[model samples]
Target chain A: MNKSYLYLFVRFVVLIALQVLIIDHINLGGYINPPLYILFILLLPFETPGWFLLLSAFALGFSIDIFSNSVGLHTASCVFMAYMRPTIIRAVGAPADYEAYLNPGIPDMGTQWFVFYTLFLTLLHQLAFGILESFYFAEAGIIFIRMIASSLFTLVLIVLIEYLFMSRKK
Target chain B: MRHILAFIWKHNFFFLFLVLEILSVVLLVNKSYYQRAVITNLTDRFTGSINSTYSSITGYFYLKQENDKLAAENAVLWQSLKHGLVTTDTLTTQLVDTLNRQTYRYTVAKVVSNSTGKRNNYIMLNKGKRHGIEHDMAVISPNGIVGTVVSVSDNFSWVMSVLNKHSKVSARIDRLGQMGTVLWQGQNPDKGSLTDIPVHVKVIKGDTIYTSGFSHIFPEGVMVGTVETIKVKEGDHFYDIGFKWSADLNGLSHVYIVKNLFREEQVELSKQVIDE
Candidate 1:
């Protein structure tokens, strides 16, 4: 458990730094900056309790929000996605041996489940964040466009991270 | 209670989702400028619509009060206008004389009751001795003369309307400069007869009739009416001119009382002349 905790702490620091320093600054047409740090929440271990998972997601999102200069936007979206995570896993029909040691990554859940799960949560997070950021029905189209573009970008990056890290660990 | 607690604990993530979402919206409304603007604009629009509806529902209750305020403001304007201090630079015609000193003070009072259909029409004003209203003060609407105060009480005064048979106003034909007198004949409320103009003078239709200021009641040149018709009888010394009553006496709501500061002195001078 201590080793896992250390690993998660390292993962948190790395993903947040990557997102703030790299992903957030790279403006794809000025509105398509990927929310890649959500990978920390998405790849959390399957058997992590709800409160701990939410808290971890909040901490990661709050750091990103502070760095991005938008104080509550990312925290809200990330918390929503964290709350939806357990339901999504249950709906995906996890294997009988799903336990504390099993990370919900490509190596553990395979490419198909990982893609679906990450894409779904990334889309949800992007939708929440985009709407809250704009907060106007007149800008609904712009919000929709940003959500799609940023969700796709975040999904690609999350997939790449899962693939690179899982391959090396395996 | 325990079951409810169990349910909440069981769905603690759902509760957390609700709490966090509410927090986010609160923060967005309070801390964010753009989102707060949107929220406040929506709230203002909603409250504005509600307030308008409320005002519409109860607007009639304030109509009397509002009319009084407007009448009071008009009184102040009339005081300045009747004082004749300010003059336009463009036209140098001597049509309106400039009084070097302020000679008239004005106050507004609402018409509490009026009767135009009666032979002796009288209007009751909502102000009296306490409001500086006195008997024989001139009462005029925004358009023209309405009546003269006949009696006064602590909080009310009666005005003998210009449509009454006994009502008289010293007047003149503006274009001809012929002095005349306006008297209601106790018949038609819309028309008054302008008497005392010499029969040989031209009586043109649409010519304006104005107060001649001979009676010391009305100020000089206040419009009374326009000439509607003229009749000259055989061997009659005066032309009987029918003029439109410029004021809507029946619909009277607000009126100004012209208090002439020099009225008592002028009357005393006239009385001494009569005695001599």
Candidate 2:
């Protein structure tokens, strides 16, 4: 198997395990539930096909929903993030041809671009997830608050994980 | 046909991802009803274990506080015991006897793991099905009511905390006897809202709120909270009353699960007339 594909598979397994076994039970605050599984989508190889990216995102979210017992909320949010990924990437002027299998890194793409990408994706994911989870229009304000709080938490974790672990890799 | 086949082969990974995503969405949207039961059960077990681990770690720090609270509660129980005889000696024994009958029973349990910050906060208690904790049992802290039992296992149970948006408890004013539904607004863990309170009824910010005992889940007079604020819209028939929850759900350590002995029979009988 290709080294990159092997790395992706191992990371995917580890992420899923950590999410279900550890993060799901770690309730930092009433409003903040960090969704680290989203890193699976964020870390995908740049050359991964559009259809594959969208599908992987959905699968990742659906697995979490299944475990958490929330219906369809995660799936919807994951798909929304997947759909928006390309637009954000293009607007930020990252490499167009993604055939080189370049990993998304701050050092490679510059800190500003990386921050914008993470913030946009994290916010989009949280907003879609929170609204769908509430499923009630009357609770829009409460859901928005929850989304913002969770997004902030998730962004911090994402950056920290990337900085500490992925950044050290060759 | 050969060109099409080549194209498909070239994008197999893309197609595979799409298929997986669609499959996930379908599973999420069409989650089997039975799956909910299984997931809830699994969650309860996992939460229970986590809570126990946390409790064990934190138990050392709380021993002094727990001992003091227990001593205080014991004193109250002793005083009540002493008063029971004196009251019976003076009043109409029959009326007082009937009034004194235990309408509710409680199962004491240690909080293994408890949380108040999540949108759907749940507490894990050390005692469970074997200890007489069943679904819908009211879980209370020393201060006041916390939540209702949602799932139970052999050795542990999960209480959906009052902070949860899905929690709804029937409550009434302590002084005026006016009734309303208490619901968590999800804005603050320590506060909730009392809806359907008639505007005409006299209500004040400091008035006490207690469970109405209309719901089989909780007995009458279980302290829920005190009215924090009352907003009566002009021309509206009801007031939006805010409640400051008495139970400090965030710092839960010990809890009592209230079991309604007649709940099963009552539910079965009521089910014959009303679809519950």
Candidate 3:
């Protein structure tokens, strides 16, 4: 248990470093800088307690906000994602999946289930982020376009990273 | 008490989520960069240095472009030193009733971190309070006006860029002398919308814009941008206009923080007048 906690901590540092230093600078078309740090929240252990999950999510998102010099967009979005993660997993997985599996990943959960899980979570996260940033009904069209474009872009990267890195997990 | 405790334990997730979400929402609503939060301050120190380190490595790629721009600006500066074209000294001297008194001071600072990709973009400078930088100072680049200082840490200052939605610059058409406000309505880092110009003004294409110096944040007649496009709808009171900034905010690295020596006096005098 201690080893797993340490592992998550190390992952948080590495992912946050990569995010603020590298991914944040990749301004594609002055629009789609895919915030890849949320992968930390995504890759958390499925058995993570409610308080732990929400607190870690807040920490991760707040760190991003600090680097990006915003306030609550990422924090709220990540916490909301963490809050919804269990429901999302159950929605996209079998009833017996949690009892059978030790974790959530492409390797452990299978390709189809992981993809659907990641898709719903990223879409939802990006939508929340977009709405918080813009806060306008008139620019809903632009927000939708941006949310979809960014979500898909980050989704591909997330899946590819998971497949390459966590391929050995299962 | 036992029942309430048991009930809370039964659905702790919902309660935790609600509390965390509410805290995040409060942070968002406040959105003040200068908030006295230790967590944010620590992160700012870490993030500021990290950004500067990363930018130093990436700064090599833009060396050629930046050097060329500096050289071009040097030529203009050299020409002015030798009385090139019309003397702009007279024009600037007119701002000061007394001759040879400098009302503005400029401090050189490097842009360690900048972003033009957001709805409300910002720039971070290497200079801060220790370097004589303060809040509300004007930051201008060799190319054009950049932003205004919003907050200052020990070694870093945050600048709210002119491209930000909340930023408004009192500007004037150079040739026509028609005054208007320039603001960014989100998107387009290179372009900002010029508003409040009455429809009767004959605003031609390619008209130059300069800071009006009415706001007291920026000095008089700094190059703001140039008129790029204009459209007028029937019966509209003001002309719909967009101007391209003289500075390419994406490529900005070096800038000067403008400190107005007379600003306090001016503001105080205005306040005194208003008190009557």
Candidate 4:
């Protein structure tokens, strides 16, 4: 448990830093702006306490918000995605009795479940973030386009990261 | 109480979800730019549209007052334009001063009531004897002649609209200089006929027709209408002319009633000549 906590803490700092310093500045022609810090929530162990999950999600979102100069948008979307994680896991019929030390990742969950989990959470996060950022019905079309493009971009990056770095379960 | 506590404990995650959602909302609303944009978008979609629709409805109610102010301003412009040049140049001072008489005065009046569907269509104006509007004064809109005042009360006057069967005005072809009388045929509000234009004159389909100033009611060169068609039957000495109406009489809201300053003097002189 202690080792996993430490791992989560380290992952949090690395992802937040990467998101703020590099990804935030990248402009793919002002479209497909990937937000990868959401991987932090997706990687959290299924056994995490609900309140702790919510708090950590808020903290991660707030940190990204501070860096991006978008005050509450990232924080709100992150917390919302975190709140929705269990429902998504249940809907996807993940094993009810998850290992205490195990996390939702490419190595443990296989390629299909991991992709589905990551893409679902990323889509939800991007939706909340985009809708909050552009608060107008007239902008719904452009917002939908941005959300889809950014979600796909973020999903690809997260799957690539997990495949390249995570140890395969034997 | 224990059941309630158990229920609360059982649904603790949902409560946490609700609480966290509330907190995020508060942050979103209280934060700068992004949150404001969200709130603005939500309210703009819902309340903003309602407010705009409401204002648009109320805006229609204000059009009458706005039109009244516009008509009054137009009256001043028309008065100055018809009164001739008030010269300040030293060389033309003596010559221009003699010419600059206030031969015409104008009063802005709202069309309180109007009709085009009626054969003897009459327009009721908001101004009457109290506002210096008298019977026989000519009425015109910004576009063209509307009618002549036929009767007046203390605060209201009735006008003979150009669509009325009794209405007649001396008009001429602007390019041809051929004088004709414009009279309504008691049908077709959009059209009128120019009578007494002889067949020998070259009347084209698009020639402009204007007031001939012979009636002493309307000013010279005021737009009447454009000649729409010209027909000359065999053995007929006069051309049958149909002209399209220049002013939208059915939708008239603002009009100027012309008060000719020299009208009474002209009438008296003409009457004396008739009596002799």
Candidate 5:
């Protein structure tokens, strides 16, 4: 198998396992169910093409939806994050001119840039997921509360995982 | 049109995201009919397994609390049993006089999983289809009514917790006997509202509320809550009644599943009336 395909497959399996086995059980009070599986989207190769990102994000979220029974909430949120990833990367400036094969790593992108990148992506993903999950104008306040709680939790997990695992890989 | 298509081709990701978001919104809005039932069942099973694992892990920490609760409950049960036996002779005469009155039976089960913060929260019980737990059975904690069963598997069932936005129970005031519909406001799990009680009915704060038994799901006199506030809406004839739920749902570990023996017959009879 191609190295990229092999890498992507491993990443998919690891993320799904982590989400279902570990993160799903960490309720942490206040209805904060973090979707750490979005790390798969975050770690996609920088040059993986926009359509592929959109499709993969959709598939990742749809699979989670199938597992969590939340219908299309996760799928919608993941696609939104994938769509905004490029813009967010550009806004944060190219991570050293965006090398095609460069995986998103703290060492490659610097701690500060990676933090901002993960924060924005995690926030976007949580906001979309929370809003879609609530799906009621009357629930705007509760949705906001859930969004903030879930985003904060997801951000902490993303940063810890990046620092511990991806930082070591580099 | 060609230029638009070209622009769309250039911004395919953005278009795809928009389409997916729209599709999701449509699905959410049409939850009544287009809900993915199969997916829900699969997720329920997956969650059930995951929760069981976590329950085993956390069950260790909760052993002391569970033991204490059980001990306290056992004391109460013993006292009640003794009192009932002592009053048996007198109660026999009263029971014969009220032979036509309704009676309720309670079956106990532990709450395997519970959630309070979600817009549509649910609780899972250790008992299910094999345990005579059918759809629409009312679940009550030691404090008050929790919710009704929404789905059931062979060994487990999910209850739509009273904290959910969709929860509605028929309730009546204990003192005044004024009736209203109790609904979750989705703001606080400890509090809910009783709407449609006529303003003319005399009601006071702290009035006890119980199930009206109008619904096939719950039996009469199951504790619901107490009136915390009775605000007469300006220019409206109905009072906006606030209630403090009698059941401490967040702290609930064990609950009773109430099965109405006459539910099937009552439902069939009602359906016949509607058909006629």
Candidate 6:
């Protein structure tokens, strides 16, 4: 259990760092803003306590929000994503989804299941974030375009990160 | 009471989710406009250090390009100097009339972090309150207006970039003398729209825009941008004028924070005008 906590801590720092230091700096055509830090919540163990899941998700998002000078945008989206994670898992998840499976990566969940999982959560998070960030600022038509672009951009990066870790496990 | 306790236990997850989500939204709503979150102030100190460390390492990469830009700026300054006129033999008693006409003091700052791709973008500078940076001071790049300082800490200040949706600058068409408001209409960072110009006003393409000094936050005649597109819909009184921003927010590494000495006095005087 302690080892698992350490792993979570390391992943937390690594993901947040990668987000603020690298990902936040990339503004592809002003449409694709991939807040790739959501991967932290996505990779959490199924057994992670609900309260822990929400708090950690909040912390993860709050960190990004702080780094980017946005106060609560990431926090709101992350909490939403975390709250919906279990429901999403059950919706598209296999009957075999279990703690013994050692966290949900592409290897254990398979590419198809992982893609659906990442896509749904990423799109939802991006949509929520895009709306909140552009609530009174952006055009309605542009918000949809930004959400879709950002979702796809994040999806590609999440899959690549999972693959990199999956190969490392080998 | 027993049944209520059991129900609460059973729905604890949903309750926790609600509480957490509501708290997040509270933070969001409270900090939505101009209010700064107390939590963010703490976080800024932490992120500020980390960012400064990161920028210190990365700043080396931009040294060459930065040097070239500085050299070019220096050349422009040199051309305007009267050094070629030569000082005619020393020690003549000249009328010493020293008058302070400069109302703006500029403090140089290095951009440690910036974002342009997001709908609401912000920039972080290495200097802060200790460095004489204050809230609502106008920030400019070497080329043109960049943003305004929003939040300042002990050693860092957060700048709301012009690319931000909330950013609206009082603007004027230079040659035409027509007045409008320059704002980022979302999407492109390099472009912004100048609105409020009446349809009757003839706005030619490529006309330059400048700060109108209507708002004391920015000085008058600061370079804004050059007009790119002008469209006037039928029956609409105003023209939809799009202009290319002179400063590139995406590539900014250095900026100047302009502090107006008479800002408070100007504001005080203007406040009385409304009453009359």
**TM-score of every candidate:** 0.45, 0.80, 0.91, 0.45, 0.80, 0.94
- Candidate 6, lDDT over the whole model: 0.85
lDDT of 3: 0.85
Q: Over the stretch A73-124, how does candidate 4's per-residue lDDT look in tens digits?
A: 7788888998899999988777766667567887777789988888888889
> Judged by lDDT, which candidate is best?
6
Please provide, for model 1 over B143-168, each residue's C-alpha lDDT reduced to its tens digit, 9 standing for 90 to 100: 78888886665666667789764589
Stretches > 4 Å off in candidate 4: A168-170, B31-276
lDDT of each: 0.74, 0.77, 0.85, 0.76, 0.78, 0.85
Report DockQ per prediction, comma-separated: 0.09, 0.32, 0.67, 0.10, 0.37, 0.80
lDDT value for model 5 = 0.78
Q: Can you write out model 2's per-residue Cα lDDT over A40-90, one digit (the tens) per residue? A: 888786777777687777767766654454546677788778877877788
Q: What are the runs in model 5 whose C-alpha is more than 4 Å off?
A: A1-36, A49-52, A62-69, A145-153, B1-37, B40-44, B87-107, B201-205, B229-233, B272-276
- List the candidate numbers ranked by lDDT, top first: 6, 3, 5, 2, 4, 1
* DockQ-best of 4 and 6: 6
Q: Could you give candidate 2's per-residue lDDT for residues B139-232 as a string of tens digits? A: 8877789989877778877678888767899999999998899998777777889999898788988999999988899888989998888898
- Which regions of candidate 2 are displaced past 4 Å? A1-30, A48-72, A79-87, A96-101, B1-33, B41-51, B58-65, B82-102, B269-276
lDDT for A55 in candidate 4 is 89
Error of 5 at B241 (Å): 3.8
Q: Interface RMSD of the predictions, in order shown?
A: 28.8, 4.7, 1.5, 23.9, 3.2, 1.0
lDDT tens per residue, model 4, B175-198: 999999998864467888899999
Return the clash pairs for model 4, or none: A135-B41
Cα lDDT for residue B215, candidate 1: 91
Give lDDT tens digits, candidate 5, residues A106-170: 87878888788888889988887777666579878878887788788888888888888777675
CAPRI verdict (incorrect, acceptable, medium, high) for model 3: medium
- TM-score (0 to 1) of chain B for each candidate: 0.67, 0.84, 0.89, 0.69, 0.83, 0.91
Report residue B66 deviation for candidate 2 (angstroms). 3.9
